[model samples]
Target chain A: MRTITKNGVRIDDTFAEAFPMRGTALILTGPNKRWARQAAVTMTGFATSVIGCGCEASIDGEVEARDTPDGRPGVRVLIFAMSSNDLQTQLVNRVGQCVLTSPGSACFSDLVAADALKVGDLLRYFGDGWQISKKFGNRHFWRVPVMDGEFLCEATTGFTKGAVGGGNLLICGADYEKTLRAAEAAVEAMNEVRDAIMPFPGGIVRSGSKVGSKYKALHASTNDAFCPSLRGMTKTALDDDIGCVLEIVIDGLTEAAVADATRAGLAAIIKLGPRNGARRVSAGNYGGKLGPFHFHLKDLLA
Target chain B: MTLVLTLKVTPPQRLDLSVLLPHLLADKSSKDVAAIDLATTREKITVGDLFRIRAGSAEEIRFEGGSERFDGVGQGLQQGRIFVAGDAGINAGRQMTGGDLVISGNVGPYAGSAMTGGRLEILGNAGDFLGAPREGELNGMSGGLLVLRGAAGRRAGDRLRRGTILIEGDAGDWLGSRLIAGTLIVLGRVGVSPGYLMRRGTIVLAKPPALASTFVDCGQFASSFPAVFGRFLLPESRGAARLFRAPLRKFAGDMAVLGKGEIFVPA
Candidate 1:
């Protein structure tokens, strides 16, 4: 493996492979910021990776009162799934359950993409026959009556056909705690990048996985190559000085966004330096055969 | 440059000015436009005989004067703008699918009748049957917006299937009567029996109306629609959204008909 030192941390000359995903955004607004954030958080809950959650989602950012449709504080959430059909189903189900139930919560579309899912159109049925549909200036919305007065939701939220997912940064250090600290710093920097979201818990993942497990039923298992405990038993990629490695996965609406986020993350980790955070920074890939988009670490740093 | 048409003489009878539509005259020269025959009930006069037509692009057509005998002022207009400096006769914007029709002075009966799309701005008062359908038609003003800065005559929004009508002035009796579905907001006081026979629609009045006994009061409603709807009316009200929002006392009415319509007056 090729490595270069930057900001006192070794940079591995590897790349992160990202696959295409269907991406969509939702603007959840409430009478107050607290409720708006609550609805957004509740809707994005348990949506870490698409493997088990069926989707990957997180809060993109916060919108001020003036920017939201209802003139209230709002939270923008992004969700990514494997297919357009899957994305439509996931968003409708999530918004119906989480955002609709939240007090004083309303939802709108944050994206103006060509392809859109009629999420509110389906959810308005909950109001029975009392639902009112309003259209103004080419935009349509539904007012569904609920216990908290009514839930105002846009008729549809747009989705994009080509989004980038699985862009990751693997931070290796002498120990677990320091490596985790490095991943956290990288995530903080990544969070500032627009059009990208880190959906993992605390924006950090300790269990990185490879393609397949030893068992026939499983399609994925642990990455033993980077595990410190499985050193000589398998083909190990870790050195004697490296005791733990952590990862931060990023999903973005565009390839350029993913690249920008990866650069910001790598720059933040390298800025932390070896003494305080990570000893080395690397990326995960499957020889780039699985995905069309590739982000080389050295290319990003340069 | 705007196409200017000045009335040279007062026609003896009602003249159909619908022939002056922008789309029809867009590619035509002044001479060609003037050559078009104008329909009249009592006289035969081409556009050239009735007006002094100035050669200009058809994107914006302006009438230097107005006449009560000019009927169907802006009909079947798909795009562009039509401006009338003075009073317009009946059916001022009949069946207009799109574009802007602005009348600086008062308009006669049947203003904006059967218009499907576009914006009609009347700076002065409107006569009877404003935004209503033709005599035999069942639906009127299917789409688009109409902002009237002055008062309106009787039977406004009659059988309106869809669209929005905003009158900043008072409305005569039988306002929004027989309205099927649409929004009609009158900022000033309204006469008796508003929302009469309306099956489904919203009629918001800034002042109280002489309501009919058939209408049932729905009491106070606490909904997000007022503020949400206020945002949509902001630009139409010169950016003063608060002027369009008021504590509304909703009355679900036209019980004499389908009984699904609602009228909102200031509480």
Candidate 2:
């Protein structure tokens, strides 16, 4: 199949396959947006992947004061786990340690539907018998009397099957500077698309990994094939002109989410293709051997 | 003034008089209000066959004649006022959310359970769990006010979250047990464990208890009572501004749990 190239950028034929996982979202609010971001960053810390951290979470977006329950600046965080029980455990621990510990901060469940199982109902006993449960409208919230008045958290959280590792695109440029620029542009484009998150440092991954390491103790190692400096020594796939490669991994809750992110990333990269030394943009795949669903880059861009 | 339909005789079996409150009969005329449906001894009876129907507005309702076994007279009434001249049966003013319900005589058990808002003033004695929860429910009397002129049976104002319960006379044991919030003012002596497992809110007692184990004396200070009760407690001619008193004794307790709630015994 002929790969689609837009403005001298190569769109790989392979797709980023994803799998279904249980997910929950939390809303954290404080006196201002700064405190809200503080609590959010702490709550979603060390939650990049389920393989080691037991969950994958990130700040989905920021919410306005009117959208919050207590009329404060807040952020929406989405957490995904392998199962419902694991999701509940990780949520209880993270929320208890991060959001509840923060002064003038309150946590609430973003998902209001009934399917969300409750985790706060059991954790409320930390109030040490002083916890008060209030049912407003159809939602039940627990008021754990803290030092600063009360820490009101939703009694339950709504759960749904969300797509993980959905849309991933790797950028291979003429040099490190060009590759970094291309990846940064792709991240900005993907950020414009809703319902998608690139849960990594700066939305760019320099140390791309394969499924397993050469050593017996490690599960994953660096992708040496994509390394331009070690081209002749190792089984390298990059051409002579391609000097640097950076990966942009995207995960969303639905198929449209992956397609939208892919479209945005491609659009942004193509827009900056002339000035930047960006050579080509491709995708990472294991020959359709990993996750179930896939988002073909060419099909998504078209 | 809504008309009240009083049963002339107390039947052998239990009666359900939940339909006889003023708010339930608010839209009906005085004559039609008196002709409400009643279930007595497994038989349906009309109001015209029982007591007289006086013509008035739906604001006030007066019940007379029957002194034995009248049940659920003002259950779940949200507005208007109800006055029972003689003794009432079981579940009088049960779950009353708003308006006023005044019973001149004694009342049976479970009065004002699950009441979200309203006022229930009983001039005579009351049965068990007055202003308390049903058998298994967790919360009781989230809002509104409940006043008992005479004594009340066990577990009065149990697990109350909001509102005030003022009792002029003595109260039974385990009063205000597991109170979540709100104020319970017992003008008379209270039984043991008055504020058990109380997390927050104030509970004021006029008289002290003989034994003191759970509650710890926090401090003595005054509290401002809300001004809305003057119109309800005093005569109609007097305005609601005259009922201002300060410096109430504040004693915090049920410290065995969180030690946040207070019990103010009048100094």
Candidate 3:
């Protein structure tokens, strides 16, 4: 790939290819902001990649009490899956296990779309016939009796079918610390953009993967091409000077959002420059034929 | 264009003005609307006989004047707007699936009965049976909103199946009697025996009332539902939602009936 140097960081011309996915957002409210964020953080835990975790999720943003429907502090969470059915399944399971059990927590839909996932509609059975339903305007909600008090949840949450997933940035540095710093900076910048989320822990992916594995049963395995230790043993994508590589994967409610996040993250890394030990920036994709969305790093700089 | 109907004279007997519904009056000219027949206990009087009709589109029909005898003012209205500048008769906005009905003055008994969907705002006092089911219907006020800015007579919200009733002023005796399922929020004092034989529903009272022996005190607990419910009600009223704060006392009872109904008051 052709490379251009800017702000002391190498920018590859390669693009990140992303697939279309189903995504939804929910607002989890609690008596205070801490509890609401706790529930959101718990529900979004272990949801890093769709290949293994069945979904990708993270806290999109924080909402003030006045901005929320429940008049309580809330956390907005975004979830993405390969299909609508899987999205619904993951949402119901996560909300029921995490938010429902949370004390004084209530869930609401932050997204409004024609397609919907029935979270509270199925969770109400936990009430054992004691659940109460209330409807105001076109929206409906269910109040299920819980040990703490009641778990109030909206009947359905809206989902977008045209979500973009797997938008990424590959950061190569002179050392591990610099690579980590670059990834951290990129994550911080990307987080400011709405409608997108990085599902990884601390928003950095240390163990990135490729589509298939050498093992017969495994659908994916670690990406060895960029491995510093495997550079000599395999056809490596890394240069001799590179010491470490880390990636940031993003999923967004729309293609534009993913594009915006990708541009913002790349800009942040470049701004950090070589003084931060940042060496090069690139993106991973399968021959440009897999995913429909192509976010070219060079074009983003343009 | 807006249809304006001004009552020429106060009729002696209660008139079944349900025919004034949008569907019947829609797409009619001034001559056509004037010839429309209205049902009464005696001979069927034409619309031209009682009111002066300035015809326009049925999308928004206004009554320049109203009376207690103007029964079923906006009944069975599927969609459109009906504004009664003065008092309305019984069952105003009754059984309406959708629309906005504004009664600027008082209404007789059975106001907003058996409404499946719509908005009914009575600016003045309501006689009795507000949001109550009709004589034989199994459910009352199953869907829709009933907002009474003034006081209501006895049995307000009797047999309410589903929907919401917000009373800004005091409500008379037997309020929410036989309430099946729904929410009734009263900002002022409620008369004796609210939720008398209620099967299932919620009655939120601003002022605690005398309870019957059949009711059991459920104690006060911090409930966050009021916050959510209150936010949902902001579009309807400015102060109605503020009445639903947490830490309110709960009472489950009417053991004489199904016993699932609850009454909540400030602890």
Candidate 4:
């Protein structure tokens, strides 16, 4: 496989190694956009990776008032975990703490037709025998009384299949400032794509890790291959001119969504030109053993 | 085609027409439906003696004529649609489990009594005990929807355990009396002692209702229920949803019965 370069930026012939994950989507609507985004941001905060937070969640997109229940502004969030049980636990905890506590916020399951899991059914106990269940059409909702008002939440929705977790892209640049801006551009562009979330802080992961650590207790360690400081100390994958590297981690509802997001991120960085100091875009791979989903950077760019 | 049953002669006495469910008669031929047995005040009479049956197999049955002596018209109906062009006698949809019963005119007492599921629509006035339990029964209508386009008499939704009862016009005394758990929406005025003895349920009134002194007022507040209710109601009844969009004065009552039922009026 030949490495293709676009505008002096090397596109790696390798593919991103993504593993299978159970994912569910939620729509949180509020009286206004501010509150809706507030609850969403809070729910997805600190949820960069399952290794650290037991889930990888972030705001996937925004919803118009006409499209949401209660005709209010809303935000859509996607959360991915290793299993359905893990996803359910994280969903209930995050929605209970972030959404139910937020004033005028109501959470709804995004996948209406999917087999249901008990998210709101479990959370309704917070009402303490005061919760009322109402069926609007075929969807059942629980009205849990809160301090501000009643928080209306939908009960039961399931995870969508084929969600690819840990699709990654590494941006190598001449300096730290250029690398940061390029990564920022990539994150912003990818945020526009549907069915995916970056999950990392500002959608950029600075401390990208490899599969295993030298310590027996740790399953992952820092990637020395692209670390600028470790260039002289370790066998590095970076060229001599590369002084900084930033990785964007993606978890999407489908392989297509991950590919689309990857394309969006790369296009944003490529549009910035080599003058922005971005020299290469390489993906993290584990000799094709990570999972079934392999997003080849070459095919995505082509 | 719709299986039509038209009253041929005014019966001298009332008739028990509970077995004339739409699902049951839909598949019967005209001759077969006419031979159906119906109990009258005097003795059992074939349906051919009281009505003209024009039958064909279909999920729908239409009953014409403003007859007031046909009792128990849609009992135990599980599926299909029944449309009554005029008034009907007592217990129009008793024990109905599933189906849609649309009565375009007034109905006698005990409509939708002990019903477990389905939708019963009364386009005109309703007699007493609408959606209420029978004289000796423990539970009333447990499930299904009862929408009254006109006024309702006393004891409407009495002892109702579940389901929705929407009254587009005024309701007489004892509205929602002894409701176990359900929702009653009254779009117009309501008479005295509303929500009395209700254990747990919601009574939404467009106008302030005369409540018993035992009911406690819980201050005025805005709720998301109206919006939710509006989304569930049909397009023709959208006004009921609009009426609920404003702030409501909530009162939790029936303390005399150790109940937690609530009455909501537009504030």
Best by lDDT: 3
lDDT of 2 by residue, A1-302 (tens): 34677887776666776667777778898878999999999988887677788887878889898677666789988787778888889999999899888877777787755477666687688899767555422455666767765677778888777556535888889888888988998898788776677777777778777789879999988889888778999998787778999988777766677788888888888878735846777777777876777777777764
Ordered by lDDT, highest first, the candidates read 3, 1, 4, 2
Q: Model 4 off-target regions past 4 Å?
A: A6-9, B1-35, B38-57, B64-66, B234-236
Candidate order by TM-score, decreasing, is 3, 1, 4, 2
All candidates: DockQ: 0.51, 0.06, 0.59, 0.39
Instruction: Give stretches of model 1 more than 4 Å off.
Output: B238-240, B243-249
Clashing pairs in 3: none
Error of 3 at A265 (Å): 0.8
In Å, residue A134's CA in model 3 sits off its true spot by: 1.9
- Candidate 4, residue A230: the lDDT equals 89
TM-score, chain A, candidate 1: 0.98
* Residue A272 in model 2: lDDT: 83
Model 2, stretches more than 4 Å misplaced? A113-119, A145-149, B1-37, B41-112, B115-267
Per-residue lDDT of candidate 3, residues B69-101 (tens digit): 889988998889999999988888888889999
User: Candidate 1 lDDT, tens digit per residue, A1-302?
Assistant: 98988988999988999999999888899889999999999999999999999999999889999888768899999999999888988999999999999998998998998888998799999989777676665677888878867788889988887789999999999998889889999999988888899999978888999999989999999999989999999999998889999999999998888999999999889888888899998999999899898899999883
Fraction of true contacts reproduced, model 4?
0.29
**Preferred candidate (lDDT higher): 3 or 4:** 3
Query: Candidate 1, residues B1-267: lDDT per residue as tens digits?
Result: 999999898876788888888888878988898888786754577889888988898889999999887788998888999999998999999899999999999999999998989999999999988899987887988888888999999988888878888888889999998888888888887888888888887888877667899899987655656677788888788422564455667788788987878887767
